[model samples]
Target: MRMAQTPAAADGSSGDGALGRVPPQSIEAEACVLGSMILDAMAIDQVVQILHDDYFYRPAHQIIFRCLVQMRHESKAIDLVTIKEDLVRRDLLEKIGGQDYLVALAEGVPTSANAEYYAQIVRDKALLRQLISVGTQIVRDAYETQDEAPIVVDHAEQSIFEIAEQHIGDSVITLQDLLRHTFEMLEQHEGQLITGLASGYTQLDELTSGFQKGEMIVLAARPSMGKTSLLLNIAENMAVIDQAPVAIFSLEMSRNQLAERFLASHARFNLRQMRRGVITPETWTALQTAAGTLETAPIFIDDSASLTVIQLMARARRLKSLHDIQCVLVDYMQLMLYSGRATSRQEQITEISRGIKALAHDLEIPVIVAAQLNRGPADRPTHTPRMSDLRESGSIEQDADVVMLLHNEDYYHLGEEGYQPRGVTDLIVAKQRNGPTGSVPLVFLKDYTKFESATFGVEQPLGEPMADAPF
Candidate 1:
């Protein structure tokens, strides 16, 4: 009768035999584990780490196990007399069959040395029961939920992922353990130029030891400030040069447009001419060679124009598991959709920012997110972008590990008297949680839509543009 009510028995396809059989459990293993803990107080520590109260199948065993754990927490001895007294004080003595039951458990086990082994069996059985419950829930949700198919699938995947992560357990450690781990990491990074993935920019790499894992990096700028160009350059450097897998979620541009920019930037071809189908022979050959190299680079681009934060996280999780992607890029945050019940745009932005930060921490990878600034920079006397200028909400700045604001003075003085288009852009490191903040100058090659480290006082030549130049 008990077996018929078990979660595993709910599946009619499992046949009558499975429904009639008992749920996966071992009462003897539970008895042995409790007996071992009672016989030797020192053995309780090992058993507690593996088995919890719910791990015991029988109600009496569960109550006894929980009581023993409570006694251990109170620094009380685990002998029979103390166990009975504590149980009596809590009105649970008769409920768990009194002192005779405790004596029987202690006498049932041969030795306390096998406590861990007994605990493992109990844990395994508990895990099987959990799997049965999760599977039953998944089936129920599939048949009854009103959500779309993709949302349902995402929920199921997340549920299974949670179960898979159970083996990882808690990360708490003693100071001695922490010191040993730190020293090991230091030794592994000894004589290394950078401790994280290199961004391929000389000074930027120096300012940040390259983008560290599990960090949310925000790049903010006004419209047409070359934020997207700089993001692509960094992605190209990591994916093409370093052979690292990168996932790019572009809500603003199509994949074809992105590919064209990558080709022009990498091959040094004129983007305007390429768009006009007027590529010269030399440029054609260079583009072909660049395409051959880029064809093999592990860069995955998703040009979904309308992406919710939940969908983005689900796709990122898939890419990280399938391809071991080292980094992720979202081109501009204001365009992302939030399906949750947000009262205002600011609340929506806050949730989106937190979601991106959570993704970085969960995947243990650096996530570079492009953001748009407000009119604060343009209205100011200095025309400089600040962390406070981040649009929609303050949560973006709060959540980011690094905040880079792009400013090109040339944009403000395009046709002024004696004004020159020096192609110089200032990447202001306004907020860095772990390092000093400063501005790094870069040269933005408008012709190829590329950016590189700039030499001070050096001006890049700007040739005349084509009649139909997109810019």
Candidate 2:
């Protein structure tokens, strides 16, 4: 075993006490980690997994670790002599305390067995320093910012989250490492009917396998095409039947209006009649029962009239941490506000779309966002929406893992010749990043404002509205 040296200020006290208080650091641990890496070539791999070069508080240590990593990547042997030669070749040996300092580091650690532990100590201190720095910046922003309070608060939350995410370690992996987890996932799904959260539509679930985690699913349609209804129905299925917590952000509708729609759909009553004072005793009983069921369902709604993507993501992050929500649904993307820097409306939509996709990935949950199609569909003869018809920006289609365009033929050709009123709506899976694309038919009950699989033998509500219609 080598004798350990008494630790000294590796970089001569620059960052040690510059901020009034001593910054968090473990100089001895950093030295031990470096020494172990030099002592055993195998220790380099283990230590790199736990600590990056920037984790070292001393600039000299940072340079040395970075050189060691580069040498490893270049398939060079790592030892006290070779490290010193490489640093000299790079003209950094003198800056990092020269050949004597390298020898001291190599002889400072007893063994390479504790490299990981030393690396972890360095990492913990680095995280503490980062937290203090972020906290200081947040205080400065709070005390001297022209931005609104909400914007400042969002910035603070984002900075802390960035630090927390850094502690999650590296996400890159070799195919060999990935296949192990892939096989385990396959084993878990060996006999499963659905590998992801089911949409309660058999045909759609068969096509999608279910809405996958870390996916952005775009449900697009023109106005009055029942996209919101379908979004809510999927939310109901996930929250109520699948027993998964769901977060709904409705920028277009008020909470009371959404609640009324949910009640009408659940109770199988005419939405217009329910809205008016034409409810019967049976209707009241059914409404009460449906309300009771929804009251206990893990369906949380945020009907913020205006929300930027940053604010939306912050809320979703908080919801996931608090309730472990499995999915998020955002109603109609075009209505989303973007207060961030942007040159054009398309740019704003692009940022919002990208942000939503990032939110889904960061939270590891499926995010279903309702979006609008352009009038290109209306100008066409068959009125089918293409992927190009996604309104505002093409980024919506680019960021989405799956794009489903809702189309109801009856809405366009209700009283036309040779038109059949089956109340069938086609959910066109226009773009699917991982699966096959096709149209899944759903039966839309206009009276109840509900949607279900068309494969079922239930009578389709077609043609004219009921006598008490408010349309």
Candidate 3:
């Protein structure tokens, strides 16, 4: 039998500290494997074919490869500093370098991050083996016990209508007729039981029924695009005017800051004035009215920074059971955490996207998430954004049923342009797996950090925008 090789405890190679006593030979072997993998991992298809590892994690190799993987997308220098940081974190590498060493290390051929992908395959294989073993044992036990006829599970998959009329078979009503009848019934009971939430933005609602139930939406944009404002606007309309339960998970902003923004928007008080306790008597009356409105509204918020996706899900589920969360909006996707995952930012984001999607499906509500756009968008002469502009476009675009990018020309132009488009916000529907892709206009109330219907904030003077907050 071949003996397993384990790394010996470190003997202070670079003086980070004592290692875990991994054998020196094992460490050498790992370095060799990593070197070969680094070279072989050139073409993704070749690497996939050669590795044959359904899933795998090369903690030893990833120490070097993660940097290279990031470089494939852009020309980023992976110097000794970054390597030292990784090694320091793991106590695997020591910083014994100057610029010359950094330059030498940085010159190594770049590779891809196929490691995590392969690791997933290995995991699946391991799970398959376990499942087969368990399943085989179950079958053997069932046979020995001489169980009755196999438990009847639904060998037949059927739609709601099919199941409803199974016994009546051939003489069933056509699906179209049934659908028409159902629509008629729904129309008869309009505004009762089932209400397709409208975004309050006319064009947006025309395109999407205000982000339907159990939906996880990634509402991404570059800095200063007002993703928070849009959500606050929607939440305001929902909680105060429409009177629906809403929750806000704010990672960067404080709870008080958010409430202040709400007050600023709802009462048309200057955002700075309210934030710094500078409200005058007249504005205080508006603030009091806004306070009363907040007291009676169904808005919940959690502004804890660095919250993971799992934590968010658990909290969201609890909130749903308690307050009936009909819709969920994540301020931005990139801010979320993957918790126990040991993968690249892209993979972590993919996991988060899947989690949010699951949360929507399981909870039977719509979720909207804001995301950061890549720097590429800023370089374009045109103000329009696209799918490629998404920060980590890989699984985010793939998993999202609808992807909306928010932009304000006014924010971009800085008022230098001859014609300033006031209260103009762009809803660039870069991708819609279930619908069309295009642009829609929205209203931006910059100070209030809120977005309203295009005409909703039109009457407000520039300095006093959001004076007639819907709530």
- Best candidate (score: TM-score): 2
On residues 1-471, what C-alpha lDDT tens digit does candidate 2 reach at each position?
A: 343332344474364453687788987898899999898879888888888888898888898899999999999988777888899899988888778788888887877899989998999998988999999899999999998877899889988888877743564789998899888877976765578898988888877899999999999999999999999999998987878999999999999999999998988889999888799898899999999998989999999989989899899989998999999999979999988768799999999999999999998999999999999988999787887888889888889998888998788986799977767898877777777677788889989889989874532222332222111
In candidate 1, the residue pairs with backbone N, CA or C atoms under 3 Å apart (3 or more residues apart, or in different chains) clash, namely none
Per-residue lDDT of model 1, residues 1-471, tens digit only: 011121232222234323476668887788889899888888888888777787777777887788888888899988989888888899977766667777888888878999989889998888877777778788999999998766777788778766755762243689999899878877876754466777888677777778999999999999999999999999999998889999999999999999999999998888999999997788788999999989988999999999988898899998998999999999989999877778899999999999999999988899999999999988987888878889999999889988888999888887789876767798877777776666788998989999989877432221332122112
- Can you rank all candidates by TM-score, best first? 2, 1, 3
Cα RMSD (Å) per model?
7.7, 6.6, 23.7
Query: How far in Å is the alpha carbon of 28 misplaced in model 2?
Result: 3.5
TM-score of each: 0.81, 0.82, 0.57
Of the pair 2 and 3, which is ahead by lDDT?
A: 2
TM-score of 1: 0.81
Off by over 4 Å in 3: 1-181, 184-195, 415-423, 456-471
State the C-alpha lDDT per candidate. 0.83, 0.86, 0.60
Candidate 2: deviation at residue 446, Å?
A: 2.6
Q: What's model 3's overall lDDT?
A: 0.60
**Could you give the candidate ranking by lDDT, starting with the highest?**
2, 1, 3
Worst 10 residues of 2 by lDDT: 462-471
